[model samples]
Target: MNGIEEEDPIVFEISVVVPRRNLKLENEGFDCVEVLVNEFRNVGFFVDRVLGLHDEFIKLAAPLETLGVVAARLHMKKTTHIGVDLPFEWEEIEAFMRQPDGSLFSWCERFQCYRHLIHFFLIEKNSDVTLKFDGIEIQWEPGEALLQRLELEGIVKQVFPLHDETKRNKLLRSWALNWWDLISQPIDEIYVYYGTKIAVYFAFLGMYTRWMIFPAAFGLILHFVDFGSLKLLVFPAFFISIVLWAVLFFQFWKRKNSALSARWHLNFSVGTSHGYKLSGREWNCLQAPVELVKGSGIDKTKEKEDLQRYEWFGYLRRFRNDVIVILSIICLQLPFELDYAHLYEVIESDIMKFGLTAVYLLVIQYFTKIGGVRSLFYAVIYWWVFYHALLHRNLMILRQVLIQRLIFYEKQEKARGRFDWKDTICYQGGEKST
Candidate 1:
C-alpha cells in the first residue's frame, strides 16, 4: 500500500469485466478469473478485483521497476541532449537517469510498456487446459496469449486506459478550468500527463491562435478605417503584410516544433522513432523476435522486399483514398457549388439571394454531415457564409464569397497538410501495428 501510494502519478487503471455469476465458481479446478489474476500478478501488475451487480471489475497498476525493465528492453529513444537509450540493466539501475521533471517516463511511454507486457505474456503448452466459469469451458490454446484468446472468446469484455484521478484533478484546476492564463499553458505538465501527441497539438494551437492576432487586427483596420482614394495602396500593403506574417509565423512554428521534439526526446528524422514503434509491436505476445528469427532465419532480401512492398502498398492506399475523395467532391459538391454561383450571379433580388445563400449553406452542411465530418473546414466555411449573408451588403458581395471560399479551402488544405506532417511519426505505420 505504501509503494502503491507513492507511485500514484504513474499508476494506470485497467478494468476487466466479468459476469457476476461467472465471478465465483463452485467446482473449479482452476478458475479463469483466478488464473488471469495470477498471470497479471506474475507479470508485475498490481491487481484489485471489485464485485458489482452485473459484472466484476479488476483494476491494474504497474510499479516503476516493471515499467523501467520493459522500457529498457523496448529500447525507447531518449533525448540525445540528455542520454542515449540503452537496455535496462536492473543491477546498475542507479546509472539510469530520470527526465528533467524528475519522472522516469511520460504517461504515454508508461502505458505502452504496460500494453506490451500484457499483450505479450506467453503460455507454455503443458496440457489441454480449460478454465470453467459457471459451466462455461473457455479453451486456452498452447503457444498463444491467454488475454488475446479470452478477448476473442468474449470473456475479457474490454481493455482500455484509465485516468489517474489525482493528476486529472490537478490538470483540471491548473490548466483546463483556469482562465486567468489565456495564452500560456502548462505544456510540460500537459506532456507529462497526456503524452506527446496531445501536448504538441496544444502547443501548436496556442502558437497559431496567438499569431492570428496580427492579421485579425490588420483586417479590422482595413474594414473599419477608410483610406479614401488610397484604397489600392492599402489593399496591396495589407496583402503583402499578411503574406510576410504567414511566412514568418510558419518559420517560427517549425523552430518551436523542433525544440519541443528535442525536449521530449523524440527523434523525427530517422527510423529510430519508427523502429521504436515497430519494436513495440514486435514485442507483443504474437511472437518473440528470437522465435521469429529462429523459425525463418534471417531473410535480409525478403525483408527488403517486404519493406518496399509495405511502403508501396501504403502509397497506393493513400492515392486510392485521395482519388475517391476527389471524385466524390467533383461529382457531389461541385455541381451544387456551380449551381449556387450561377444563381447568385443571375438573380437580382437581395432577399432571394439571401434566402438562396442560406439554403446553400444548409446544403453544404448536409453534405458535410453525409461525409461524417463536423470539422474545422466546414465550421470556417459556415462562419464566412453567415458573415457575408447577414452583415456584408455591397456590390462585390458575390465576388467576395468566391474569393473567401477559395481562401478558406486553401487554408483548410494547408491545415490538413500540416496535421499530416505532425501525425506522420505517430500514425504512419498504423496498419502494421495492429
Candidate 2:
C-alpha cells in the first residue's frame, strides 16, 4: 500500500483497457437488467459474489499494470457480481498510469477519492431481498454473525454501475471554473480524455458533412434548379438555408465547447496526451466503423481478414426475418390489390396525395409487424432508388455503399467494444501471458 498527503488536487486518469475484442460479460441475458438483479436476489447472500469479483479484479489488475480498469471491466463482463464503478484502493492497486498528462497515479488516490465516492452506495427495500443505498439487508437464519442480506433478487434484477465521463466532465469543468478552492484537484486528466472524444466526434461530423452529404447534394440541387428555371424545385432557397442553418449551429457549438475546455486548461483538439501515442491495435476503438470494415490483411498464416467480419448466422437470420416479412406483405396485398392499384390516381392528386401516403404508411407498419421486415424495407428502399427521376444510378450506388457500411455497423459492434448482445468477439489471446 502507498500513502500520500491529500493537500493537492486529485487527478484520476481515465483507463483505456477495454475487453480484447469486447467479450460478453454474461453469455445469456435476461429480459432486462432489473430482471437479472431480481434473479440474483432470489439466491441467498449474493453480495459475497460482488466481493469475490472485486478480489478477482484486484488480482487480475496487479499484472496488467495500467489495465486495472480494463481488467475490472472484463471481470464485470464475464460475471454480473460486481462493477468497475467502485474506487480502487491503493493498498490493493499495484500500478496504473494516467495517460492524459503522462502522470503515474497509485497507492494514494484510493483514500483521496473516498470522499468523492461517498454518495456511490444507496439503500432501499424490496419484497424478496431488500438491497438499498445504505447497504444490503435481508432475511436470514437466527445464527448468522451479521445483519447483511445474503441475497438481492425480488424487485431488482441487475445493475450496471458505470461512470459517465460526459456527465463527470460537465460537472468538473463547471465547478473548476466556478470555484477557486477546487483548482488543485485532478479533474484535468479526465476532462481532457472526454474532451478529446467530443472533439473527435465534431471533427468527424464536420468531415462527414463536407464529403458525404454536401458535395453530392449541392451538385444535384444546382443541376435540378438551374438559373433559367430556379422554380423547378419547391423553395430552392429554403433547402439551401436548411443546410446552412445546421452548419451555423454546429460551428457555434464547436467554438463554445472548445472555449469551455480551454478555460479548464484542457486541449479540445487532441485526445489525452497518452491517447495520441497509443498504437493502432490498442486504439482501434477510436477509428471509424467503415474504416475498420474496409481494412483487411490476409497472409499465408491467416486465411481470414485481420479486421472483424460479419457472421453468416446473423445475415441468415436477418434474411429469414426479411423473407417472413415479404411473405406477409404478399398475403396482405392479395386482399388489397385492387384498392392499391386504384390509389395511383390519388397519389397524383395534390390534396389526396397526403391521404394516400398516410394509408400506405399505416399499411406498411401493420405488415411490418407480421414479418419479412428487413427484406421488405430493403425492397421498398430499392424501389425508391430505381424509381427516382434524377440520379437514378447514383441512388443505387449510394444505396449499396450505405448497405455495406451499415451491415458492418450493425454486426461489428462488439469488435469496437460496444454493448451488443447478438454479436461479440472471441478472445484473441488477450489473456494473461505469464
Candidate 3:
C-alpha cells in the first residue's frame, strides 16, 4: 500500500443556508434563495443546494466565512436589497460597503458577502429554501455592509444640466427675425403654398355673409308682416344666423389666429439664415427700397429715417387695404339684401356690384400712398367690427344654444319626476286648487 498513491479532485458542496425565523427571508417569499443562486451563477459560481435551517445560530455559522471568501474570489456585482421585512437601516447597505473612493466593485464584493451570511442565517431558521444563482441559496439580514454598498452606488450624486438663459435668448432673437422675413414675403409666394386655404376661407366668408344678411332681412320682413306663422321663419333664420356666426368665429379664433401664431413662432424658432430663398419672379417684381425711391442720396442718417418711415407707412397701408376689403364686402351685401326696388329690375346688378367693389379696391391702392394715422384707425375699426360682429356673434350664439339645451333637458327631467306636488295641490267640492 505504501508503494502507490492515488490522486482525486477536491469536491466541496457549497450550501447557502437561511433561517426560518429570519423575517426578511420569509417576507421575500422564498425568492431570495433564487436571487442568490442566480447572482452566484452571474459571477461563475456553481451552486449545489439552497437550504433553510430551523436554528438561527446554525444557519449563521454554516459557511458564513466561506461565502465571503467566494465573493472575494468571484468579484460579484452589487444589487439593492429591498423587501417588507428589511430594516430601514439596511437602506444604505450598498453605501456602507462602498470603498472610500466610491468604486462599485468593492461595494459589490462586500454586498455579496453580506448576502451569503444572510442566506446562511435564514436557511438555519427556516426549512423552506429556493435555488437561485446556479442553484445557490440566499438569506436576508440587516447590517452596515448593505448601507455602505448603497452609498458606493453613487445614487445621491444626482445632477441636471440646463441651457444658459442668455444664450437661449440670443438664439430666440435670431429665430424671430428670421421668421418675420419668411412671413413678410410677396403675396405671390404666399399664394403658392396657402392659396387654397385662403380661397376656402374667402368662399366660406362670402357664403356665411349671404346667409347672415338673408336672415336679418327675412326677420325684419316677418316682423312687419305680423304673421304668427312667419314667427317660425324667424326661428329657422335665427338658427341659420347662429350657425353662420359660429363658422366665422371659428375661422377667426380657432383657425386663422392659431395659424398666424404658429407660423410666427415657427419662423422665429428656425431663424432667417434657413428661410426659403426668393424666386426669380419675386426678385424681378420687388419694389425699390423707400430710401432709394425717395432719391435720398445714400446719407446714413437720412437712409435710416427713410427706412423707418417706410416701415411705418407699410404697416399702415396694409391695414387700410384689409379694411377696404372688409367694407366693400359689407356694403355690397347690405344693399343687395335690402332690395329697395324690384329684385331683378336691373340686368347688370351683380356686375355693377362687382364693378363697385373693384373701384373700392383701386381706391385702396391709391390711398396706400398717403399713409397716416387715419389709415391705421380705419383699418383697426374695419377689422374690429367685422371680427366682433360676424365672428364673435356666431360663437356667442353657439354657446347660448348649448346652454339652453342643457337648461331645457334639466327642466324636462325635473318636470317628469323628482318633485312632489300632492301637498301643494288639492281638490275640494269638484273645484281644483293649487
Best candidate according to lDDT: 1
Please identify which of the two predictions, 1 or 3, would achieve the higher TM-score against the true structure.
1
Count: clashes, candidate 1:
1
Expressed as tens digits, the lDDT of each residue in 1-434 for candidate 3 is 23122312222222333333333433443444344444445443444543335521111111323443555444333333331211112223342232222322232233345444432322233343332222234323332232122123321121112233443455456443556653222322222223334534544554456556755786677667766755533554454354445434544545554554333222222111232112211211234665243453456775676567768878999999988966654543333222311121232455554343344333333333233224532343233334333533566543543344345445646765644444334334236532
Better of 1 and 3 by lDDT: 1
Q: All models: lDDT? A: 0.69, 0.37, 0.38
Q: Which stretches of candidate 2 lie over 4 Å from their true place?
A: 1-98, 101-206, 209-226, 229-434
Error of 3 at 198 (Å): 11
Supply the TM-score for candidate 3: 0.18
lDDT of 1 by residue, 250-282 (tens): 678889999997777765433233331232234
Give TM per candidate: 0.62, 0.23, 0.18
Q: Is candidate 1 or candidate 2 better by TM-score?
A: 1
lDDT of 2 at 294: 44
Which model is ahead, 2 or 3, in terms of lDDT?
3
Residue-level lDDT for 160 in candidate 2: 23
